[model samples]
Target: MHVPDWLDAARQRELLEACRRWARPPAGLRTVRTPGGGTMTARQVCLGWHWYPYAYARTVADGDGAPVKPFPAWLGELGRRAVTDALGPEAAREAAYDIALINFYDADARMGLHRDADEKSAAPVVSLSLGDTCVFRFGNTETRTRPWTDVELRSGDLFVFGGPSRFAYHGVPRVHAGTAPGDELGLTGRLNVTLRVSGLPGPAPGGGRSGPRA
Candidate 1:
């Protein structure tokens, strides 16, 4: 589902400012290195849980080794509202949406077609786009080839995929640089914040983390 202009200018600026802060040091934005040893062009930062290639970790296992930033309750709330608006209240359950992957894309950056299959939860992915426009390719679950729909996602646009499309393959093939109202939003590239339910085991009773820190 797509919702255009979901966030007004003020809200877009607010999110841009937040992304600027989140791109700071410690467990901040950095290029992702896949387990296959190839580095991804887009930079990324994580909240609630650190995403390292094909798995989740509490710290940047592939980078600075800092503990990831905590997931903001308000961000999760925004995702809930997006899901409710896109998929309806019946589809928006009180799932503990904990993972947020924010990616920065320049004009040359392109993400290969892939599936959001690492997380255990079947919850929908709530994606919010800010800054420049991009070609978002939504593909099937079985393959990453043709038979996909390419959607033009602009600033303040919201895209939520769930239900039968929860594990579908999707990616950003190209970013239209300078398409953003950079003078106002203070962003030249594209910013995508994807909210998901990690579904990893919760914290133990003693304030310790549960599940494998893989």
Candidate 2:
């Protein structure tokens, strides 16, 4: 429930710049209505010294297991700091989160209610918002039925869900247009990078996970 505005403009710029450099639009970057009745477009760009997913020597844009955004280690560390600041270092045990799916949302883009269950690890997922804003819908674990919470997600804000809320059903129902940083940054869309440690056993091998792949 803690949203940190601690990431200053400079830090935010640093994150956005790094993300752009490693941007890789997934094969499905085009507009499509998801099962949850919302439209969305996204690209998966890998980050770090290695390209990711593949984890080969050179970081290439095309390959398996490639990261969507290679945010600097320092930035990830900052996310841990935010977690620690909010929930303490004990909760920051997994500071070295390595995979993220950078989701780009246009004006009409929307995401249906779902859960982040791809990763084997139940560690917290740190989501950073850049450009634009939308209604982030969160629901309970039982089913996508009634009883839910609507939280507005803005630029430069962070949302971490672990512990009891880790497997909570969540999604984006609406995205306001022209809410992201423009061409000056060489980007004109809403970017959301969610960092996590993946490749673990969950509900099932390829079952009900609700996040994009590496």
Q: Please, what are the lDDT tens digits per residue for candidate 2 over residues 96-213?
A: 6655566777676667777777555777878888878778887888788768888877777778877898898988888877765564334466778777665433211121222122
Estimate the TM-score of every prediction: 0.93, 0.71
What range of 10 consecutive residues in model 1 has the weakest lDDT sum? 205-214
Residue-level lDDT tens digits of model 1 in 64-165: 999888777777778888899999987777655788899999989999999999998899999999999999999998998888999999999999999999
Best by TM-score: 1
Worst 10 residues of 2 by lDDT: 203-212
lDDT of 1 at 197: 90
